[model samples]
Target: MEEKRQTALVTGASSGIGRETAIKLAGKGFQVIAAARRMERLEELARQVQGILPRRVDLSDIEDREKFCQYLSDLPEPVSVLVNNAGYSIRGAIEDVSLNDAKRLFEVNLFGLIRVTQACLPGMRALRFGTIVNISSMAGKFAFPMSGVYAASKYAVEAVSDALRIEVRPFGIRVVAIRPGFIATEFNDVGNEMTGDLLARTDPDYKPVYQASGAGVGKMFVNATVPGPELIADIILEAVMSDAPKTAYSAGFMSKVFLEQRATLDDDAFDRFLTETTGLTDLKV
Candidate 1:
């Protein structure tokens, strides 16, 4: 007998890991719904991935978001998977960052994710089979300077996925969180814009630290050493199809090392790791 075909909704499918994952899933005979704010890009993706439903959705808005969820929930076909991959980052010290910026970050990264999950749960429950995949970051597990708020937001996501996994286990729904270290994408380009006002207030004592951190991020972007986004796409594929997908998936070489070190490092060792990785050793804290 032929295997049953399923339907999947992927957010942030305009580019990066999300786009590749959506395409891969579609290739596997899954009817894919590619959701993102960029309609043109999504349309292009639809052409490349046969049977894809390219829907424009700004997950940041709660009301319009409901419609996207409703689209999947009401599908005559069962909605078997949801990949919550839409998120952005604001690079700056938490205290110096503007409240609005932080709010926007959380609205998209946290609130938007929650809304979609809530909207889809009922449909999944009815079917008694579903997979919810959330894209988190390595930053969620380990802390470093200038990422306090962003890390906090991802930490919340990580926590939510953990608790929800058990809560929904009884209902036959699976929740998996994928934490990527650093796959080059527009994610960093937007993160670089920490607002001029925020930059102007950077502490003179920490100038070297900021400069070093900036250079490290730039090099990481330019070097592109991490495995390509396609690797992540593959991981997502396994997560969705495997009967025993891990609760959390970590990708990239550095990311794996960082996660392992994070599990064993003391405060002093972690501080050293951050300093060496970001070239912040010369900076006065």
Candidate 2:
């Protein structure tokens, strides 16, 4: 007997983990709607994949996002599987990032996810079954030097997922947060572009901070392999298909090490650890 097909909506499906997850879900008998700002890439994906349906929407734009949400609400099948994978980052210290830039990041990363979830919840409630896979990051648990703005967004995502899991359990809706660490993707490149020349724009005091943090980050991958998006995409599929999925799962390079330390360390101890690891301990401007 053929397995019943489910409707899955994957945001940011133009590239990286979102694209891979959409493809994998389609292979497993899902009618996958691939949403992204890049209509060309999404259309390309749809052409290559039998079950894929490409849709374009820029999550950071409030008007466009609201339109997308309304479209989701109107879907006939009601998205039982929603992968809120559309988010990007900007690298900078607290003072370096403009308030507008930070707000834009939140608009896409946190607010967009929340809005999409809201759009999908009604159908899930009606069916009494659904899975929401939120693609968080290791940064969500702990901030990295020069990456505070991005980390803050992910932190909010963690909070939402944590609370929503309990709130929606009675309706059989499962919310799973996936924390990926240092995957090989264009996500970092996008962050660099979005952040502009951080060192150039930042105060003189922050030069050393950025250099030290960069050095520390380089040291982290001396002999390690940075897995591709498939690793997390597979995890998302597992969670989506599972009868009982974990509330959270961490994968990719350095995720275990960093997450475990964050879990075990006290605030002061963790602060020291982060500083030392990020080469910020003796950073004196």
Candidate 2, run of 10 with poorest lDDT: 197-206
Candidate 1: 10-residue stretch with minimal lDDT: 190-199
Against the hidden reference, what TM-scores do the models get?
A: 0.90, 0.97
lDDT of 1 by residue, 54-119 (tens): 999887777788887787677787677999999888877766787988888898899888988887
| Number of the predicted model whose lDDT against the real structure is largest | 2
For candidate 2, the per-residue lDDT at 90 reads 92
lDDT of each: 0.84, 0.94
- Model 2 agreement with the true structure over 176-213: per-residue lDDT tens digits: 99999989989989988998987887778878888999
Off by over 4 Å in 2: 1-4
